[model samples]
Target chain A: EPEVTQTPSHQVTQMGQEVILRCVPISNHLYFYWYRQILGQKVEFLVSFYNNEISEKSEIFDDQFSVERPDGSNFTLKIRSTKLEDSAMYFCASTKGVSGGSSYEQYFGPGTRLTVT
Target chain B: AQSVTQPDIHITVSEGASLELRCNYSYGATPYLFWYVQSPGQGLQLLLKYFSGDTLVQGIKGFEAEFKRSQSSFNLRKPSVHWSDAAEYFCAVEDRGSTLGRLYFGRGTQLTVWP
Candidate 1:
């Protein structure tokens, strides 16, 4: 089965530095999403992307954060300034959106563990 | 706001024993429910989902779930669990019934299967 893939399984960066997390969603998927999980905590949604634009975002996705589909296959999340609170497991997910039908399931990647010091 | 509750934080079961993890949700409308499992150092894996259906949904890895609308609960069950089934399980809800919507996830239940 095809699955979403994320690069740099672990990332360590200094506070105030910029960090970019990369992901390659399933080839045929149309809707992409970003989520984060604090250590030993529930997973929280960050943003959802479709058609190269943001469909929805949470308060955690503030000014310092942005997402890009630079290529047809790559979806990237960038944090302009990393903070201690930013350390978490960032997961990339995708799904084949149902067309005119009800809906389909979303798949998640292994996630990139971001550590800010 | 939509929220999910997983009452059990941890559970231990002997190999080949039956298991059930509880989950409840607070959503305004017809909810879309999903069960995901995460092994150590791995991402979340989908087990099953409940949409408009017969209420009893079967999923991979010998897992199943029942959606009880009256109780606002979607609990996961395994008739016989293996050692490999030890992992963290999460129940999530998507109120919008689509991937475009956000998924509110429960805190998760950690299952430990003893050999």
Candidate 2:
């Protein structure tokens, strides 16, 4: 079975530095998403990307966050000037952009743990 | 605003005992519910999902979840759980009315299995 894969499983960065988390979604998937889970917190949606554009974003997805599908398979999330609170496990997910059938199921990657000190 | 509520914070069960994890959601439109499991320091693994048709949906790893519209609940159940079943479980709902596939996940329930 094809699955989503993320690079740099663990990252440590300074608070003021920028970080980029990379993900390679399933080849045929059309919709991609980014979610984050702070320790002891719920997984919150950051943003969704489709057609190489952001479809929707949550309040937490502020100016510091941006997503890009630079290539056919590569989807990335960049955080500029990270804060200490930004440390968390970031997950990348993708699914076929369809309403009915099994396309709605989102396959998640192993996740990249971001730690800002 | 869509949200998922997993009431129980933690649960413990002996090996071979039956298991059930509760989940509730508040959504305006038809809800697409799913249950996912995550072991310690591991990624989320989809256990099952409920789309349209039947209320009772079967998923991988001998797990099943029932969607009760009246209660706004989608609870996951297992007939008999093994020690390996101990993990954190999350219930999520797909936001089909708004975004392409943005998911709202619950706080999650931690399951501890005794051998």
| CAPRI category for model 1 | medium
lDDT, candidate 2, A2-116, per-residue tens: 8899988999999999999999999999999999999899999999889989999999999999999988889999999999999999999988857557756788898999999
Candidate 2, residues B1-115, lDDT tens digits: the string is: 8999999999999999999999999999889888999997667888988888999999999999999999999999999999999999999998887667678999999999999
Each candidate structure's TM-score, on Cα atoms with residue i matched to residue i, is 0.96, 0.95
Interface RMSD, every prediction, one decimal place = 2.9, 1.5
Poorest lDDT segment (10 consecutive residues) of candidate 2 chain A: A97-106
Q: Model 2, stretches more than 4 Å misplaced?
A: none
